[model samples]
Target: MYLGIDIGTSGVKAAVIDEQDRSVAEAAAPLAVSRPRPQWAEQRPQDWWRAVELTLDALAADSPAAMAAVKAIGLSGQMLGVTLLDRADRPLRPALLWNDGRAGAECRELERRFHDFTERVGCRPMPGFPAPKLLWLARHEPAALDRACRVLLAKDYVRLCLTGEAASDRADSSATLLMDTAGGDWDDALLAACGIARTMMPRLVDSAEIAGIVRAELAARWRLPAGTPVAGGGGDNMCAGIGVGAVRSGDAYIGLGTSGVYFVANDRFIPSRFAGMHTHRHAVAALYCQQAVVLSAGASLAWVGGLLRAPDLSSLMAEVEAAELIPAETPVFTPYLGGERTPHDDPTLTATFSGLTHETSPLALVQAVMEGVAMALADGHEALIESGARVGEVRLTGGGARSTLWARLVAAALGIPLRLQPHAQTGPALGAARLARQSVGGPLIAASGSEAIIVPVEPSLREQLLQKRALFRRHLHLSR
Candidate 1:
């Protein structure tokens, strides 16, 4: 059996799979973020470790033999967060998360410092990325920087705690803006641009390479075999792609979690200069992928649910699906609660609900939020196509994928058949498991091909959706 662990923004997940790619057991532990200030998201590194422990304990309770038989471990997590460690591998401060927008000024300074930076890094310096976050720390939290002995990504930090090794994979490092994405290594010039040193970085490795082994103490504590090899693993998004068999060229998937993304794989490195798309190395070695992101997807929905005093997201979504449209008077929502990335790298952007009136019902407002996210995702899909990405179909994954209404909205907006995986919600953790299996010469599972229950475009909603999408864009521009 192979073990795959994904440390996500809101939780930590673990899964055990057999050689045939059958899931033997799976478990997850929920996590909470500390938003002490607006535009800033922080998490305690210890919480990730604790969550991992809880997940492992649950897995052990489910099937101790499967946990013990784990031959290799693979890890995946949220990308672009900075976890500063002291000499003793303790966190210096709360990790700056991928959604944290406190590095906007630093991103601008980075652009001013480096010429042709986007060409080198395959992306512009956005606030959520790690490099600018590090720069922000250097300026605002110099004490933390001075005391730091290593800088690790979210998964790498977990790896250090598990294996006593400090290492990172290319797929995660590619988004740091501290590495040459095309060259697949740290760039000294880029490090200097961020006022950081190369030594601060962990050793880089391939996603499938053996990064380290579970330490004797932790292994004994968790009933895991000592010295069991752990693969370098990948960023959660890349692993999610791998989980759904999106390894080959043009294979793509969309994630609708706290953030939203349209990801497509390619064999060669291709960076966009003006479109604001992100080009990074794939979890699969020698392959690359391009992505367009929506900073807030389900997050916007959650915010609205809280505002309307909805008991939970599921009930809220049900209300949204049943809600009748106002017909030519429906409002448009811009799901930029955490700013945006693709096509607009503005970190200061905030969300808005336009066209709201006394006549608008709570259900209409909920529908606007869902449709807004769909339109945002549609814009990303179109941007990917404009950049020459050949997308046949899209696989929807994440918590948001649970809603039929949202899927239909996205399908109509993007005008593509959207597929839902059997393990759509757990694709990242499953992909992490697949990576662990692949590292040990396991059979490569083919992409879970087209499902019969695809969310196809609704003829009646097509023209109305087009108009709403246009209005969404206009609202985005007006908000900016």
Candidate 2:
């Protein structure tokens, strides 16, 4: 058995898989993000470690035999977080998350300081990237910056607790804007520009390589063998690509989790001139991935559901699906509850609902939010194409993929077929387990036998969504 753990923005998940790649057991624990100040999102590093332990304990209780049989472990997590640590490996403060948008000014300053910033980093500096977050810390919290001895991403902090090692994979490091993406190593000049030292960064490795071994005591506590190797896994996006078999160039997938991502793989680095489109190293060596992000995808739906006091997201979406709503007549929603990334790169943007009438019902409001997310993803798709990235039929992975109605909307909005692969919601965790298997001499990028359900474009719905998209863009422009 191989084990995989994913430290997501919303929760931490642990999965166990057999040698045949079949899932043996899985468990998850919830995590909350603290938005203490406006435009800032933070999570305690210790909270992540506690959550990991909770998940592992649950797995051990249910599948002790499988846990004991675990050969190797792998990790995947949210990328670009800034976790500052002191000399004793204690967190200096709450880690800044990827969706935090408080460093817009720092992003612009970094670009001004480095003329070749985009080319060197493989994309423009954004507020969500770690380098800009470090610059922000240097300006506003100089004491914390000065006292910091190490900086780690979200998953690496958990790894430190598991193995007593400060290490990360190049796929996660490349997104930090502190690494030379094409070189697959840390860039000293960029570190200096952000007031960070080379020694502050963690040692980097390939995603499928063994970075460290689990502590013997902890392994025993978790029912694993002594000195089990831990693989250097990747950022959630890259691992999701691996889960869906999108390792080769031109392979594409759309992720619809807390954030929406349109990912396409390439053999070489191809930085986007378009703002907010990310180009980073793939989990697989010698490969790269281009991504367009919608900062709020499932997040937007969750927000509305909470406002309406809905029982759950699944039931709320069911209500929307049952209602007979016209596409063009619904309110146009700009899902910038936090901010936007792809095509806009505007951290100042906020969510807006236009064309709301007295006749608008709860069902209409929910439908509008769903359509709004699809339209935003459509904008991302167009941006990727404009940047000369070829996107074909995309495999849909994430929580939203379970909703056939939403899948149809996304497919019609993008005007491309979407394949709903088996075990889509488990993409990142499964991918991490796959990497763990590879670390222990398993197959590389192996194909699955399960077939996918395809959602094809509806021409009539596509035309209607296009009209709604035009209105959506107008509202976005007006809000700006």
Candidate 3:
């Protein structure tokens, strides 16, 4: 038996899985974020450690019988967050999240400095990446930066707190936009561009390799075996890719969380000419993935529900469903309420709602949020497919995938089948658990008996949604 932990923006989830890939027990603890300033998202690394503790404690309590059987632990976490630590291993400052845009100017500087080595490094400059956040720290928080002795991604930080060792793996490192996409190592030119040296980074390893064991003090505190192995896990997306049988090259997946990411796995490096998406090495050796991000996904629905004062998502979604309108029926909405990340990648763009009339109902607002998110993901799918990646049928995960209404709309608009993995949730943890099983057992990835089916929708509504999406794109610039 082993444990798999996933540290996400929303929460930390822990699952205890047997060698047979059966999840015997599971636990989770929610997390919250703080926005001290607009366009900046920060989370205390301590909160994650606590979440991990609570989850593990709950699991241990639920079934004390599994405790002695536990052998290894695997981790998966949000990507591109920067957590700085002092010489004594204390957090130097709040973590800068993947969604933050404070490093835009720094990203431009990096592009200028490394124009010649862009392709070799595996990425172009982006304000949302980890290295840019480091540059931002160097410029604005130099004092904190100077005092910081080590830098870790969100999951690695939690790992250090448990194991007393600072380390990272390739999958999360690639998200920093600092690695050689082809070679699976840090790019020297990217280092020069960021004015950072290799020493500043943690030792890199494969995702399933043993990172370290839980330290004696922490193990004692948690009442666990001191030498329990902790394996290096990759970013949530890649690990989630592992959770599904998408470990092989050319396998693709679509994840819908607060934001959405469309992923396609590969055995070789693939870079995007446009900055709309990211290319990275997979936790699995010689594998890579192209991931396109949509800035607002389930968040759009949450916002709509709050704005309409709906008590729950069902109520809001029901309202949206009741007022279904065609392109000829109502108006247009550019769903840039949150700064866009995919095809547009525009920070200055704000969401726009056109065609609102005196007859507009709260239902219309709800529908816009739903349809807007669908449109955003549709645009991402188009860009990813256009980039020459073989996007097979979609595999949907996250809160949005639970919407039968949404699944039909997205499938129709994209003209592809959307397969939902059986356990619509905890895909990453399942992936990590599989990786752990492989560490002692056999293969690095596996597919369970999870099943999915294609959703059905009226053909006319599908065409109408597609046409409305086109109209939204046209107005995106004309309104600008």
Candidate 4:
């Protein structure tokens, strides 16, 4: 058996996989993610650790045999979250989340400082990336930055807390926008451009490489055997790819989480200077993958659901899906609930529910929200293709994948088939499980599971969505 744990934004999930790559036992525990201020999201590193400990204990309690059967432990987690830790492995400040947009000025400064070395930084200038967050701390929270310690992301912090060894995986480090996506090493030139020393980084390792075992005290407290091998796991998105058998070249994953993404796996690195697409190595092996993130995807429907105060999410989607939305109407939505990541990478962008009148029903409004998100994802997909990456059929996952209407609309907007997965799990925990199996010389990919599939079914809606998408482009406005 292998243990796979996902350190997520709102929770932690631990799963024990049997020899057959099936989850024999699993447990999840939720934690609080705070948005203390607008455009600023933070979480304590301890929260993720505690969530992991509790979930692990629960899993062990449920299956005593799992304790001895576990051969290796793997991790998957939220990407781009910034955690500053001291030499003693203590957190000096709250970790900045992936969605936080407080580093705008810092990002601009970085762009100015690294005009000559932009290509070395792995990706384009984006406010939510870790480098800018580090700059933000250096400028605004200098004491915290000066505490003289390592800066790690969410999963790396969890690895440090468990093993007392600060380390990072290629997949997670890719999100920092600081990794040499092509070279597969930390770009010292980019690090220097950010004014940070090399010592500040943790030891880099492959996703499958074993980092360390559980510390004795914690292992005993969590009722686990000592010296359990903890495999280096990729960032959540990469893990998702692993979970769905997207390990080979040309395999693609279209994630519809809070943000939407069209991820394509490639054998070699592909750079897009204008498209701003991410060129990062695959967490499982030597090949690289290019991922394009839409600023807001599932977030649009979630926001609308909350506004409606719908008792159940599925009911809300169904209710909206049953309604008819006129194609001629130009209801433009930017889907910028939390700002955006791909193409524009703008924080000043605001959302709109334009082309609205008293005649627009609540259900129609909901349909419009889903359509808007689909259009945004299509925009990212097109930009990436324009940047010269070969586009292929998209495999879908995440909460938004549950909506048949949304998936078909997105498919039509992108004019590609959107096939679903066996399980619609977007959690990195599953990804970690897939990685754990791969590390031990199990199956090289995760294609033989109880996977599900969703194909496009609505052409009329697709045509309407395509037209609305064009109108949305015409109306897109950015203040900065």
Candidate 5:
């Protein structure tokens, strides 16, 4: 058995898979983001470790035999989070997450200093990236910056607890804006620009290579063999691509987790000229992934559900499907709850509910939120195409894949078919497990043969959606 662990924005997941690529057992534990300040998101590094322990413990308790049989472990996590550690490996402060937008000014300053910043980093420096976050700390929280001894991404911190190693995969490192994306190593100039030293970064390795061995005591506690190797896995999107067999150029997938991503695999590094599109290394060597991100996708639905006091997201979506409201009459929503990324790198943007009427119900608002996210994705799709990234049928993965109605809406919005595979929600963890298997002399798993294809909406519905999408774009422009 091979094990995969993913430290996500909302939770930590552990999955165990056998040699045949079948999932043996899985477990997950919830995590909460601390948004103490508006436009700022932080999480205690210890909380990630605690959540990892909870998930692994649950897996060991439920499948002791599989846990014991585990040959190698791999990790995947949210990308670009800044986790600073002191000399003793203790967190200097709460890690700044990818969605945090408090460093907008620092991003501009970095670009102003480095005229070719976008060319070097593969995209313009955004507030969500670690480089800008580090610059922000240097300017506003110099004490923390001065006292830091190491900088680790989200998953690497969990790896430190598991193996006592300070290492990161090249795929994750490339997104930090501190690494030379083409060279696949840390760039001293970039580090110096952010007031970071080369020694502060973790040792980098390929995603499928063994980075370290699990601590004997922790291995025993988790029912794994001593000295089990931990593979240098990758950022969640890279691993998700592996899980869904999107390793080849033109193979694309849409990740609908806490944040939404439209990922297309490439054989070479193709820097995006389109604003907010990211070009980063893939977990697979010699490959790269171009991404157009929506800062909020499933997050928008969750927000509205909480505001309306809905029982849960699934039930709320069910209510939306049952309502069958007319597209023309439904309120239009702009899902910029935490600002946006693709096409417009604006951090000051806010969500809006336009065209609301007295007769509008909670269900209408929920439906509008879903449509708004889809429209946002459509904007990303256009940007990807404009940047010369080719996308055909896209595999839909993440928590939102469970909703067929939403899938159809996204398909309609993108004007492309969406393929849904079994266990689509388990993409990242499964990809991590796949990477672990590869680390232990196994082949990359192929995409499953069984998949449900969601085609675009009918002509009439598509035309109505187009109209609503136009209105959505208009509102976003007016808001800007």
Candidate 6:
């Protein structure tokens, strides 16, 4: 058996899979993101470790035999987080997360400092990247910066605690705005621009390579086999790609987690310096992936649900789905709740609801929120296309993908067929397990049992949505 763990922004998940790639046990633990200040997202590094331990304990209780039979482990997590560590690998402070915008000024400063920043990093230096976070710390918290001796990404920190090693993979490291992506190494020039040094970065490794062995104490505590090799997995997006079997050129999928991502694989590294899409090494060897990210997906729905005091999103969604599909004179929503990415790349933007009337019902609000997220993803799809990604069909995955109404809306908005792959609800955890399988020289698992559903668009509805999109753009421009 192989064990895989994914440390997500909102939760930690673990799955145990057999040699045949079937999951035998699964567990998860919730996490909370603290917005201590505007545009600042923080999470305790030790909280992540505790969550992982809790998840493992749950898995052990559920399937002790599988946990004990685990031969190897793999990891995946949210990308671009900066986890500062002092000497002896202790966290200096709460991790600066990917969605945090406190480093916006730092991003602009780095852009001004480095002429070839985009070319080397494969994407614009948004506030989400780790390089800017380092610079922000250097400017705002010099004391902590001075004491910090090493930097690690979210999953890398977890790996360090697991195996007593500080290392990272190409996919996660490339997104840091500190990597020479094409060269697959930390770029000295870019590091200098951020006022960071090579020694601060973790040792780089391939995603599926064995980075370290599980420490004896950790293994014994978790009921895992001692000395099990732990694979250098990948970021959540890349691992989800592997989970869904999007390893080859032309393979694509739309992830609908807290953040929506339109991901496409490439046989070679193809970086677009001008476009907003991100190009990073695929977790699979000798391949690359391009992704267009939407900062809010299911988040919008959750926000609206809370505003209406609904118990959960499902009830609101059910009401929306059952409501009549009118001729699109409803409230228009722009889902910029956590700001925008992909084509826009604007961190200061905020969500807005326009065109609400006295006649607007709770159902209309829910529908508008769902449609807003779909429209945002459609914009992301366009951005990916502009980056030269040749998408055929989108395999939709994540919590939002489970909503039939939202899936239909996304499919109609993108004007493409979407396949709902089996076991997609597991998301990154299963992908990590798959990587663990591959790290041990297991055979590649083909994408199987996916049901493709094509939602046809109505001409009238398309025209109405187009008008709404134009209105959205105009409102966005005015808001800026």
Backbone N/Cα/C clashes per model: 0, 0, 0, 4, 0, 0
- TM-scores of all candidate predictions against the true structure: 0.96, 0.98, 0.93, 0.92, 0.98, 0.96
Candidate closer to the true structure by lDDT (higher is better), 1 or 3: 1
Give the poorly placed runs of model 5, Cα more than 4 Å off. none
lDDT of 4 by residue, 168-231 (tens): 8877897787777666678787676665678999888889888878898877765567777788
**What are the RMSDs of all candidates, in order?**
1.8, 1.1, 2.3, 2.4, 1.2, 1.8
- Model 4 worst lDDT window (10 residues): 443-452
Alpha-carbon deviation at 26 in model 5, angstroms: 0.7
* Deviating ranges (above 4 Å) for candidate 3: 220-226, 318-331, 446-450, 456-458, 478-480
Whole-structure CA lDDT of model 3: 0.77
- After TM-score superposition, the amount by which residue 86's alpha carbon in candidate 6 deviates from its true location, in angstroms, is 1.0
lDDT of 1 by residue, 100-207 (tens): 999999988988988788888887888999989988988998888988889899999999989989999999899898998988899998787666788989999988
What's the alpha carbon RMSD for model 4? 2.4
Residue-level lDDT of model 5, residues 242-332, one tens digit each, is: 8888888889999888988999998877887557999999998789889999999988988999999887798888878887876776799
**Model 6 spans > 4 angstroms off:** 324-329, 446-464
- Model 6 lDDT tens row, 1-480: 888899998899888878777778989998988999877889999999999989998987888899899988999999989898998889989999988888889878887988777778787788888998989998999898889888899999999999999999998788898999988999998777666789988999988788999999878877888889998899999999888778789998888887888899888777766545788888888888899888878777878888999997777777777786552746888888767777788788888888888998888888887878888888888878877778765688887776787877777778776777666667687788878877888854633634445455655556666777777677776434
Please give the range of 10 consecutive residues that has the lowest summed lDDT in model 3.
441-450
The true-versus-predicted C-alpha distance at residue 407 of model 2, in Å, is 0.4
Better by TM-score, candidate 6 or 2: 2
Model 6, 437: alpha-carbon shift in Å?
A: 0.9
Clashing pairs in 6: none
Model 3 lDDT, residue 440, Cα: 57
Across 316-398, the per-residue lDDT of candidate 2 in tens digits comes to 88878877677866899999988899879998889999998998888788888889999999999989988888776589989
